[model samples]
Target: MSKLDPKLAERLRSNADGLFCAVAQQRGTGEVLMVAWMDGEALYRTLTTRKATYYSRSRQSYWVKGETSGNTQYVHEVRLDCDGDTVLLIVDQKGVACHTGTRTCFDTDILLSDSVE
Candidate 1:
């Protein structure tokens, strides 16, 4: 029982592994929070429940964000890329979005080594 329309689901482009890339961003600030993957069922659950649900590649299961960490993401809008292979989710994020306890996942910076020739 999917809440998504059959036509819309069929139109989406999935990777060979049957997963689509989903990027979550802050609704107002437009800050990118994190990137995750979603299958059709996961996408349907997110759209229907208004919660950020993702497919865990390692766990091999559907996980609702903030379910354990209290960092839930309430979806404000969902957008599909022009290629239909990527999804962007504008959401109201609660608490820290990263498991490392950072506000977002993109905190680390890679510095170029001065020793590089």
Candidate 2:
């Protein structure tokens, strides 16, 4: 069981401009469910409440997954990658992971990259 790094926590708190990527994975089959970002407040909320919360750059607020849609994610474990800038959450998801009510956010492919100037 790897404990969260105190130093890493310090960096995360200090860098309010930084948003660490938080990836949610299925606990049963180890499939990646979704990817989001976590700011300090969101991280604290997730650690304390065991509910997956994330920071939305566009919304400029903390978005609680499943708060409105009933697709909540109960965190089983949170792991920091070796780089300490990304996070992985092993969670028990209720239903869809996408805001549009899809099974996962990864379901749709973004074609923007191809249209880049």
Candidate 3:
């Protein structure tokens, strides 16, 4: 049902729900913004439209980043991992990337780190 190119679709390795990981990072800063999931249709939309489109697992629907919030992610490039299980989206982010209004989703949590020594 996806309108994705057959060749590109064939390379993807999705999970049981037919979704793959999508990581968004700031284009020039190289800062990781957020992580999401995407189906073939979402990927197709992102590629064609240059917008960050993701499949929401809890909502059971698709969402385009910045569609609701004014915080937008204008995608500059997309790269699929060699294993095709994950994708990296380079983007120019406007405003905060986290739903919590932080610049990035990872900003709040710091699990563990080695001593600086």
Candidate 4:
């Protein structure tokens, strides 16, 4: 794994608990898979290992996506939002991206009524 750029690392704006949002998307299809969190170490690990790694807020530990599901996400590229508060990961996903065996975590649909007052 290569070393993380100190300057780049410093540019991130983690919240009070030291975490930033990390969004994963399908490389070519542009399908948003999931939203996770990342601390400095998690971000560094993801970039160095080229795998989608996130900080588990509930578990309070680092989690490599698909570590147990066999649905790994091979990172194609990582981009930082303009404000440096969020990260976007373009990945080649394997199998399902959601734990529910779905291709994406955002499968829920919302309905809007056409009638307006």
Best by TM-score: 3
Model 3 lDDT per residue over 30-101, tens place: 999999999999999999999999999999999999999988899999999999999999999999999998
What value does the lDDT take at residue 65 in candidate 2? 89
Q: What is the C-alpha lDDT of each candidate?
A: 0.92, 0.82, 0.96, 0.90
**Per-prediction RMSD in angstroms?**
3.3, 5.9, 1.0, 3.2
Least accurate 10 contiguous residues by lDDT in model 4: 108-117
Alpha-carbon shift of residue 103 in model 3 (angstroms)? 0.3
Candidate ranking (lDDT, best to worst): 3, 1, 4, 2
Q: Roughly what TM-score does model 1 have, to 2 decimal places? A: 0.89
- Residue 77 alpha-carbon offset, candidate 3, angstroms: 0.4
Tens digits of per-residue lDDT for model 4 on 1-117? 225677987899989988999999998899999999998888889988999999998999999998998899999899999999999999999998988878898886547646876
Lowest lDDT sum, 10 consecutive residues, model 1, at 108-117
TM-score of each: 0.89, 0.79, 0.96, 0.89
The sequence of per-residue lDDT tens digits that candidate 2 reaches over residues 44-102 is 78988899999888888888889988999999998877766788999999988878777
Q: Which segments of model 3 are wrong by more than 4 Å?
A: none
